[model samples]
Target: MPDIIRLLPDNVSNQIAAGEVVQRPSSVVKELLENAIDANAKQIQLMVKEAGRNLIQVVDNGMGMSATDARMSFERHATSKIANTEDIFHIKTKGFRGEALASIAAVSQVELRTKKEEEEVGTQIIIEGGQLISQEVIHIPTGSSFQIKNLFYNVPARRKFLKSNSVEFRHVLDEFHRVALAHEDIQFQLYNNGEELLRLRSGNLLQRISDIFGRKIKNLLIPISEELEWVKLSGFVGKPESAKKTRGEQFLFVNHRFFKSTYFNKAVQDAFEGLIPQRYLPSFFLYIEIDIERIDVNIHPSKTEIKFEDESSIYALLRTAIKKSLGVYHVAPSLDFEQNQDWVFSIPKKDSPIEEPKIKINPAYNPFKENSKPFTKAEKLNVTEFYSSFRNDDITSDLFDAPSANNEENFLRLMNGRWMIEHKGQLWCIDPYRIHQTILYNKYIKSIKNHALSQQLLFPLERPVYDLEKEKLISIQSKLFAQGFDMQIEDDLLTITAIPSDILQEKVLDIIEELLYQLTEHSEEEFSVFFSKSVSKVSAKKRNEFIQSSQIRPIWEEFKNLEMPYLNPLNKKNYEIISIPNFE
Candidate 1:
């Protein structure tokens, strides 16, 4: 047998390398933006078309490259930032390996135009599929411009794996935010398909954050600053009021480079332990400055993961620093102000009659009574009968057969939105909230998938949305429409002419805002589920209130109607039965 192993050709090797360096259009965006920053550009404009499937251009006004350097940029392993192995440990620039350009050029059509400030003319280099097409003198400005076109054109499989335009554009926006956020002194502007999405002016970190997010973020942030022997940290963490159900707003950077560390994130989350809800995450943008030698950034091809020398110490310090900052300011904002207190001692009209409410006392009921039983067995049959109704459905609930419901008006309702039922000497606890949420979720999904039912409002409702959430809302407009949300965007106002029949118009804005937050962290599919869940949650609360005042007859009927009543949209148990011990 002949020796099968052979060295891969340059073009093949570069294409293979591109697989890791340029996984998606957003990956290309990250590389180009970092390169512009490494060039010491004061003003960088990122221009994209068709969500980066067609074009991705980065124009910068910085120190330009020479003609020789322009030609050498597309060569594999060719770099200007690194000299030897020792230099790798003490690196400062973003693009040092030089594989970015070479791998990027191998998979797409690239055009580079650059000229030094002192040079009278510029050089233009074009490469297609790793082949240099042209290198000629051209008249241009005193900076660099890189235009990447037809990303992954040669590789059909990669292109086939690309997500929707909305998703791709969203990812691009994420990269843009990460880069623009870490460097506050550099100006960055983003243009998506001819429309200017973001215009970030150079300023302090706080102002930069407000520019990227909305002006309202200023009120929600708590400033954090600390300096130690090995590490110095400074950033703003979101107040508890600013915490959201989604966890996408957190950002951590080192040496003006954005990276991700789960350990560090836990440090921040731990700091906000009692301030925010358990599932909710407070937004934070933390910057840490340390000696470059103490960390490693080359672990991943994207260069977003860093391996630190004393990670445990850094984690403890970060937690303590954030906790200290949180203590300095109040977590919950006080919205109440001084007002009239006349209502506290109101005097009714002289002729008006006031009736004292009557309270019924159970004469025989006593906590000390040994004969006090859990809920009666009749309520057991009510629940057993409810589950038995599902026996006709294909998915059997594996519950025991029970008799028909005898009056459910006497069932006991616990204070915490739970219903007590007795079955076979076992006390069965039922959660009406989870049941209603799940039923509404299934109904909404069915409506959205089949044909949605919408109610046209008498007048269009206008809701104020910030610039940060506008893109997300717009991206899923079609999906929202399918779910019966007919919306139009003009500036920051989102006008809704119709809403789903299941949703209350009064809570539409809140639900939409929650949906926007969900979209920030979840994909379109996941966001749709979250959207349904949120709407169901709102509807479920109202439903629970209605059931609270009325008898349990309606609840029994609703439970009996569901094909699968056990699945909860909130990932909680609908009901649980605990056995009661018999004591003589």
Candidate 2:
């Protein structure tokens, strides 16, 4: 037997810490930007090359470090944020854990240049893989510039596992946006591969939001604010009409730190229960200011998830604030039992001749004239012949089970926007929207893989956008084209002349907006799913627009081909079946 356990070397220890702190290139961006914010920088500049794989540089006009402090900054567990254990509870700065710099340096090539405001000269310290290459006094400005290059160079496995440049760039862009939005008073500029991608001027939170989103969204915002003995909540909630089918526009912060909490998000969603359409999430930029001792920001490595001492009270007050804002802005209906009834019942009298309600109908219309080949139920449902008329080979062969020789196949559109299908001897209720989404999702994944063709529009549509949005849209133009959207950036506008053939032309503009928002706010994998769902709703027939059973035929026809016809794209049951109870 031998004693095998030994203390890991400092380099090995830091490399292990890097695994937690520096998950990807964007993680580096988050650390550097937050460090700049903590430095009291009025203007922060970030530049990245090849989506941060080649280089990531952050320069800030903040109070810089001295020659001795510059060298100590790279040492693991050396930090200025905390002195005693009590300081941990009252954490105010972004970079509290001193492991960030050391961890980042262990896996990458880092060069730090810093000079204090009163110092006549600066210090340039270059370190590679936790080993100091050089440290010398140099003439520099009164700030700090951290240049991290060849990220994960010492860790070849992690470098190889990085996503494509486009995808990685998106992650970096998201970090930049989050930091910029969290601190609206500090100007931030982002550059990618030498081109200025984003410039956020210092302003109020609402101004920053409007600038980033590239729209006059002020009209869509309703201010909300409330203060209790323990917590204060204030921010802007988008009007119900401004709610979207996607979930990108929501931003929540605690003491100017961006974090994600579905628990708190549900409070906002519950406030708009009946105001917005089902399955649609409202947009909100909420800020919570509470005692630092009552909340723990160290629950996660990235500090994006926090624990509140009394979340229930916070939730109750937050939901109330949002509901009050909505009602005050008249975005939600208000009931006043004290109002007089005479004005409500009286309509302005018209002097013109009274006109009878006209019945609009098509006299020559017939419901049985479907373009697909039809066979009665007696033929045992010739699925081979039926799918052939669809001209799609992707459809699976899971149409239905063997039908009884009792009833004919029938589709009846129910008043509540569901479908009633009488097949064989059973009746099934179907959610057409979910079925539609499943079909569209399948089709879209295939299209993306196959590089489907686009359908050109008769009229080119131009949407006004800010310069920042144009740059972002142009960057992801190739990805959009792969999904069959031909988008171009003209002066101050995003122009589209074509879209996916399966998409509805009437909603081309809205679909484009959702696509851009989702791509900007989510990862590539999530954007695909969200894009499909958003388009499915806008393209599918509205619940109130059903004229006959024929409109539902397309959804039914596509749903029958699903590998699991019982479930929708989200894996939820789209239909319910009930057997008849015999009365003997």
Q: Tell me the tens digit of each residue's lDDT in model 1 across 497-521.
A: 9998878889887687667755643
TM-score, per-candidate, Cα-based: 0.77, 0.75
Question: Candidate 1: what lDDT?
Answer: 0.82
Q: Per-residue lDDT tens digits of candidate 2, residues 1-584? A: 99999999999999999999999999999999999999999999999999999899999999999998999999998999999999989999998988889999999999999999999999999999999999999999999999999999989999999987876876787788789889999999889899986788998988888777765678788998888898899999988877875555788999999999999999999999988877788989999999999999888789999999999998898888888777766676544423434447746478866768899999988898887776777565676667567745344332332344654367776678887887556788988877776777788777666767789989988876644445457766876777788877854567788888877787887776665555542454555666666676556555666545667766676677785378765577888997778899
Each candidate structure's count of clashing pairs: 0, 0
What overall lDDT goes with each candidate model? 0.82, 0.82
Estimate the lDDT of model 2.
Answer: 0.82
Model 1 ranges with Cα > 4 A deviation: 332-431, 442-468, 478-501, 505-510, 517-533, 542-553, 564-584
